[model samples]
Target: MTNQVQIWTVIAGLGIGTLFIRYSFLGLLGNRELPEWFLRHLRYVGVAILPGLIAPLILWPEATGGSPDASRILATIAAITIGVWKRSVVGTVVAGFGVLYAVQYFTG
Candidate 1:
């Protein structure tokens, strides 16, 4: 078990580190206009980040003890199919969740 002093020290260190990391971006570059190329590339940050964030949950869900679950896999497929066929974000999400719940309901 960690002592109170050590725990507070670590917490304070992390707070300071997070502050600096955020300040380095907002404080330093907040005034300057970013280049067009950088801005253009930044548009895809969401495209990259969404998959990076969601892939692990679908592929190795903690609910399944780090193994892939069929319901989630089928949901992903349904979502992809809806995304490709309808090209609608809302439709894709609805399809994914709808399939996920339906599969889990039937399977479980």
Candidate 2:
């Protein structure tokens, strides 16, 4: 795999990116206290990111190529089903992945 990119570089990049990303929030917050206005608005971060969280599922489902297949669709439906039926986030994710993998095995 001489022509292939170095695995270390890819890992290093992932590490740097992860560090920078996590640092952006934790580092800034840990350095000093943020203003109350910023704190007041912090609650909205979840609301603001809500669309960012769901947009890919509906619009760019194919972006990830494999994970977003029909199994994922069924898994998402399963997640919603768990949320409605059990109202548990942990249960939803677990059940969703299970549903996805099970259906993927059957289909593939």
Candidate 3:
């Protein structure tokens, strides 16, 4: 396949897969109450996925060509510490980006 065809094929596949995943939950079970155990587990899903999402960016940022950067690492640490101490989402995000920008600016 041509590059454009290949890209469109992948995009269409991902769209269909995402729609199916959403429909499986909302279309089939939207009105029903999920089991207590399931609900409890679901509550932690975001918390679990967040670290997985952030870890790669911190450990091997694309900007650094997949090498670990000190600024990103320190920012992550600051963000985690602020999150634990303040328990504030806004505070955590502010601290993380703030540290990331400040360190990058000063060090470079």
Candidate 4:
């Protein structure tokens, strides 16, 4: 198959899979409250996944061609600190980018 065909097929499959996953929960749990244990665990999903997704980038950024850099690592640390302190996603992202750029500029 052509690359475009393969890409489209994957996209379609992912869309259908997402639809089923969403529908399964809504349909199965209609008008029912989720168990407290499950709900509590679900609350950590974002926290857990966000760090997992970000840690690799901070440790070995693609922009640095997989090399570990002080600027990115410090920026990530600052961003996490600001985020936890302020509880603001926008502030955290802005701080992270700002620090990353500043560090790159000054060091280079």
C-alpha TM-score for every candidate: 0.79, 0.52, 0.77, 0.75
Question: How high is the CA lDDT of each candidate model?
Answer: 0.98, 0.81, 0.95, 0.92
Which pairs of residues have clashing backbones in candidate 2?
Answer: none
lDDT of 4 at 61: 85
Residue-by-residue lDDT tens digits, candidate 3, 1-108: 479989999999999999999999899999998899999999999989988997898888899999999999999999999999999999999999999999999999
> Which predicted model would earn the best TM-score?
1
Report the lDDT tens digits of candidate 4 across residue range 14-97.
999998999898887877998999999999999889878988898878988999999998898889899999999999999999
What would the C-alpha RMSD of candidate 1 be, to one decimal place? 2.1
* Residues forming the 10-long window of minimal summed lDDT in candidate 2: 58-67
| Per-prediction CA RMSD (Å) | 2.1, 5.6, 3.1, 2.9
Query: Which residue runs does candidate 2 get wrong by more than 4 Å?
Result: 1-37, 57-68
- Sort by TM-score, best first: what order? 1, 3, 4, 2
lDDT of 1: 0.98
* Stretches > 4 Å off in candidate 3: 1-20
Better of 3 and 4 by TM-score: 3
Candidate 1: segments with Cα more than 4 A from true spot: 85-87
Greater TM-score among 2 and 3 belongs to 3
Q: Which residues of candidate 4, in runs, are more than 4 Å off?
A: 1-14
Q: What is the per-residue lDDT of model 1 for residues 1-108, given as tens digits with 9 covering 90 to 100? A: 999999999999999999999999999999999999999999999998999999999999999999998999999999999999999999999999999999999998
Evaluated against the true structure, the overall lDDT of model 3 is: 0.95
Candidate 2 lDDT over residue span 1-108, tens digit each: 643468878888999999999998898878898899999999899979977987587445765663556666778788889988998989988998899789878987
